[model samples]
Target: MHAPMPLISTMVGGLVLAFILGMLAHRVKISPLVGYLAAGIIVGPFTPGYVADLSLAPQLAELGVIMLMFGVGLHFSINDLLAVKHIAIPGAILQIAAATLLGFCLGQMLGWSLITGILFGLCLSTASTVVLLRAMEERQLITTKKGKIAIGWLVVEDLVMVLALVLFPVITEMLSKEGVSPTEILYSLIITLTKVIAFIAFMLIIGKRVIPWLLIRAARTDSDELFTLAVLAISIGIAFGAVELFDVSFALGAFFAGVILNGTEFSHRATNNTLPLRDAFAVLFFVSVGMLFNPAVILESPFALIGTLFIILLGKSIIAYGLVRFFKHSKETALTVSISLAQIGEFAFILAGLGLALGIADSKLHNLVLAGAILSISINPFLFTIADKFALSRLRKNTTLTDTTSKETAKPIDKQQPMMPFSDHIVIVGYGIIGQKLLSELNDANEEVVIVDHGKEKVRLLKMEGHHVILGDGISEEVLTLSGIAKAKWLFITLDNPYETAQIMQMTKSLASHVKIVTYGSHLDEIEYLYDQGAYEVIEVKKDIAITMASKVIPSL
Candidate 1:
């Protein structure tokens, strides 16, 4: 139990140092990302200072990644992903292939085995999602067309790495004296794919409904504490669950969790609520990445380190840029995408660790990856600033896919459709299962209904059913006005995301204070906050469930 103190110490100590340096980095007009990395180095084993617990820092760093990816998933959209699919999907595949070939050649020259070479190449291929996201978010480029392309491209890299992690062992077994068959490798790949598919399906179908429902229940309790806990629970639980049960990467799991939520009304709220936690731990993640660096690699193998750096920083960037351009995007878009991919991160360390454990990689190779990650991540922040100064607004304005730029502002829908003026109607903010249920009940009661949803599929279905539907973000004032909130008799907020729920609540009351406001809370602690936010009625979901369940179970009493 006492051993855990070191873990706590590492977290607290790492944050303190990171904060100080991060402030300094800001004062110097550089990205705080540089300062975070520097802080990690100062506390890392490579430097001559108070070293943190290396083992413990990584586990905490994982939490940071889980939160960060969840935040990304919050603002992400399926449409954004599809827009870049042409460039991102094939671009990432070929980029990884090219990088691996480069690494393989370098390993051959270094006299390492084919397996080691492949692993080496594999590490070089994928850019650090953490690094890329932090850089993109710093400049507020994540929701832009180019940002989506980079994000989609990174997703491909993550999926490939997951596949590689599954296959590494089989290949290692073959290379061993007790050789394995090709059949074994094939079978392993199949099993890995099966797990990956199962996880994705589960998240999209089951988790989508379950996670949001749980959060809605949590929100109804009106407990700010519980609502926040519920958000962390959903994000961290799904992320860790993916790794432990499905044997996938934690970031991939969390990223998908956020993406799944993105399809729901709760996305913006989830992103806003999780931001502080994500930013704090994300800093820790950078620090942890820095902790792995061994400065000795520079002196011992300057040429080798330079070669590795060249492959990661220059080679990958050019390949990514060329691929984006091949897909017919403007040079500005191509270069923006390329510069983001220039750095490698968390996934590289994971691969290196596995290779070292399998005896396919030596300590020297591990050091190279670590050193390369530190250098790229530290310098990549400046590279992004340069890209911004060079490209700035031109990149966004000049994309070949013009719709990709404009449509990102809102879900591109046909404007020819007439707005149905819903009067004396029940205006609902979300169109999830609860909202749908309430919509049905209100219809059964012969009440006029106006439903607002961010989901195109739901809007389509609602329109087909002859219901008044507004297909825009609930957070938007224009969307709210379209929903006729001021004229509506009753406003029902049924989004599972408490943050979004609270936001909409404030928006609704501000728009129509005289209109009756009824909303649900996911936690016991949320009731007061909801009241403060102008809710006329705040129903705590869990308490209601317990009361209803108790009434049925102990009626004799």
Candidate 2:
């Protein structure tokens, strides 16, 4: 294979593997990440198929990292990160410290070097944003106070992880060289900080001023490919400069580029186009990381592996839960935030790479930690189930360790919550005929009703009709918050999906335990599930339709 061709070949092979395995994973009810990891292992050097030459792949994968971080930055406004810093910064630090300490202890017990131990801990210290976001989306938790706080914490963690990546290399380069002194370390630190500060200042002061103008010019041209390429160029260019000029990691540059572009009006389009590219490369990156796993070594070090897993999954969960509690989040909110952030993610790989470059991590150690990371990501969803059960059990016994101090911390809305008598009441989850009929009935009754729909046209139509409507994902807590679920006396889930209704019901129960919940579903099983989730009444639409038809026929007869 030719130089760049081998890289292309590996990328193609990895993406195909990811797509196929990802579909299979979905069919089997597992995370697509597990499939991606499995694909990497199958096509890795240890397996029989086309071995992806990772040396070339990792370099390309760096593009993926840049784009991924860029996307993260674009969606994440600094205001949000700053607002939640209280929980995010402390939660991240404590979680990292706990995981690192546990890894060091496990490393000593396994007779590994202190460096290897630290590497293991570093890998475990980070959580996968991709996985966490997907999980939060699935659970309809993404729009909650808990979700916002959790993601904000991840943001801070990524920033800290970036800084650590920069520092590790400089320190290692100096220490590994001959005649290194304390003064050299100080100088290296100063030089690194200067580079970082200068790079950030340039991005904020310079990039921000220039990128908007550049994007507007690109948009005027109306060339999607050019615009896309422009986005990529800016991202890669900044990242490269950071690495070459400031001695910062390319990831930091990519992040800064994102932060810069985040201020621009063209951010949404930039992200939309870059997402496909990001997904393709990110899959390859995950595959490449999986290729480093030496299963034999991991199996041999069973005690260490098991111990590390506990620390990453259990210990980190505890730390996050405690921090959330200390921050005065509710029991449910604490559990929710903790469960979402229990797995290691992209920064773990970055740290592992840094450790390897610093000679702090050997092949065996890297492989061991990488393998464990994949395992954690794979099992994260299942672990959430366990977490929910544990929380429920604790809640049942009224022994939840929750943060009850922050009265300002918003709680998720609950159905069945008490409400003032005769308050305007409307519960709209969709805008279809069923919802329209319900709305009409409420209007005739002279009650206040709120419409929740993500459909743009429906929201517009509802607004034109003088109906109170909020446009957003109905399943999202933010959407519910906007809908004033906490104040509503009645909730009508007219959405067709019973699972979504169940989530809304559960989340509503946390915020308002006395509001009435009425839901409509097509299936009896779904209706039953909705009922179990605290629905005061679940009407099977199909059954009701049949009953109405029979009543009309009997009357005619």
Best model number under TM-score: 2
lDDT, candidate 1, at 183:
80
TM-score of each: 0.65, 0.73
Global lDDT of each candidate:
0.77, 0.75
Q: Candidate 2: global Cα-lDDT?
A: 0.75
| lDDT per residue (tens digit) for residues 1-557 in model 1 | 45557877887878899999989987875557767877887888889968999887667666766776676667556575587788888999999999999989988888898889999999988887667876665544555577789988987787688678766775676558456677867776688778878999999889988988987887799886787788888878898899899986676688788888777666666676767878888888778867776778889999888999999889999988899988888786788899999988767877887787688889789889888876787788778767765652342232121121133433232222224444677888777788989998998999988887755578778766767777655655556666677787888888665666677777777877778888898766687888887888998998888888988978853
Residue range 1-557, candidate 2, lDDT tens digits: 44567767777787788889989988876678878877877778877768888676467557667777777777767777787888888877887788788878877787777656766777787788888888876765555567788888888777777777778777777767898889988998999899899988888788888888888888899899989988988888888888898778888888888888878888878987888887777787777777666677676777667776787778888888898999888777788777777777777876776677677777766766667777787788787777556643442343111122333543432333221222446667877788889888888888888877655578667766656776555655555665667778898888666777787788778877878999877767787778888999988788888888998869753
